[model samples]
Target: MIAIKGVSTITVAGLFAEVGDLSNYRDPRQIIKLAGLNLQMNQSGYFKGQTTITKRGRRRLRSLLYQVARPLSIHNEGFKELHHYYKNRANNPLTGKQSYVALSRKLIKIFFVIGTRNCSFDETRMLRDIPQLKPLQEVA
Candidate 1:
């Protein structure tokens, strides 16, 4: 987790303390739901309510992730760019708070990947999906 910019040793410790062990989780979505960052909505065909985070799990984990997101948005290159994309995307743009929530969930996924794969964070891989945000290619 510390491999991710803006994440410190203490933050990693806190996350682990709250989440127990990452190996227990078979998928990142499990952690996302554990943090209560998974999306949920009320729908009955005739009426569809606004979608929002389930906010149903460990409160400390959710709070910790949310707190980490602000600095990640400012200091982490990949996270910063992703945050901008979330806010400025052409379809259903998110407000600032909503963007932060999304970033928090993303952070959980990053933590899970790094924990499982034992790999360092890669900024390029994080942004390659968005054509406009993808880094420019070098001239051969």
Candidate 2:
């Protein structure tokens, strides 16, 4: 896999080293769970509490992803746009930090695709596929 924007060589190596082989995982969601990035909902009967991460997997992996996400959202054009979209969406806008967390999860999925398929990252495809991320002019 090639180096993604804002992803350093060390970060990429660390990620690959942490993951080892991607064959065992059935899907990207599995990797997300492995990183403890899977959402956990605190809902019981009629009481629905906040949704948060499980935090039950590799702590170093989760921390590394978050560390990368913050800079990725600031330095990478695609990631930056996505981060802004996530934080400003109408339905349920996330805080800046929350958006970065979400981005970290997204990065996991991206890495999964890259590792499994041996394909390079496609920023334009990502931006295009998420229709909700279209500019305000188009939405309006």
Candidate 3:
């Protein structure tokens, strides 16, 4: 098992400082909410508006995740593949920024797993989580 590469030390330390103990979170989704990275709906009666992040939590933590997202998408093979899949998938493909936000959420999840479970990062498992990425794996 390899250490999770490409994640900066400062970012992880900063995230831990903001989030305290990962045990406090029931799951990664909870961590995502804490970072205000969760998707929010804007629906009033039948008029549904554009969905966006809530941006209601620690600003620094949120910003850090967002900042790491771009580099992670480029330098990390798993993240890069996931980023491409998010942008090009057949159903409701995300725009560039949207994909980054999604990647940020994913980073939060990975961080949560690391902090709470004390497990090494698994690239194969990470890619397996998203079915859309599977075929791309075989091709590449």
Candidate 4:
């Protein structure tokens, strides 16, 4: 976490404190849902309402992640690209706020991976899943 440009030691510590052990989570999405960063559909009957975050979990975790998101978007190259991709994608683009929420969720997933794997952060790994953002390799 500290290796990420925008994340400080205190922020990482706060995250661990709020989320407890990441191993308890079988999937990172569980932690995303726990932080209330997961999206929820607000629909009833035949009326299809807007989708929004549930905001149903630990408030501190949500706020902490959001707080971490601002700097990550500005200072972290991978996250900056992701935010741009989210906002500028041709299909169903997200607004700036939505992108931030997405970033926060991404951070949670990254934290989960690193915490469980006991490895350092890797920018290429972070963005590898997104087809549009694959890192280019040098030709021999």
Go through the candidates in order and give each one's C-alpha lDDT.
0.86, 0.85, 0.85, 0.88
Candidate 1 lDDT: 0.86
lDDT measured at residue 17 in model 1 versus the true structure, 0 to 100: 97
| Model 4 TM-score on a 0 to 1 scale | 0.93
Ranking by TM-score: 4, 3, 1, 2
Model 1 C-alpha lDDT per residue in residues 55-124, reported as the tens digit of each score = 8999999998889999999998778878988999899899998999988887888888899999988888
Instruction: Name every residue pair that clashes in candidate 1.
Output: none
Choose 3 or 4, whichever is better by TM-score. 4
Best by lDDT: 4
Q: How well does model 2 score by local distance difference test?
A: 0.85
lDDT of each residue in 1-140, candidate 2, tens digit only: 44687898889888877777888888988888888999989899999999888898999999999999999998888888899899888989999878988999889988888888899988776688677766742664
TM-score: the better of candidates 1 and 2: 1
Candidate 3 lDDT at 87 equals 97
Per-model TM-score on C-alpha atoms: 0.91, 0.90, 0.92, 0.93
Positional deviation of residue 105's Cα in model 3 after best superposition, in angstroms: 0.6
Candidate 4 regions with alpha-carbon error over 4 angstroms: 135-140
Model 3 agreement with the true structure over 35-119: per-residue lDDT tens digits: 8888889899999999999998889889988998998899888899899999999999999999999999988888878778888
Per-candidate total of colliding backbone pairs? 0, 0, 0, 0
Superposition error at 134 for model 1 (Å): 2.6
Candidate 4 global lDDT: 0.88
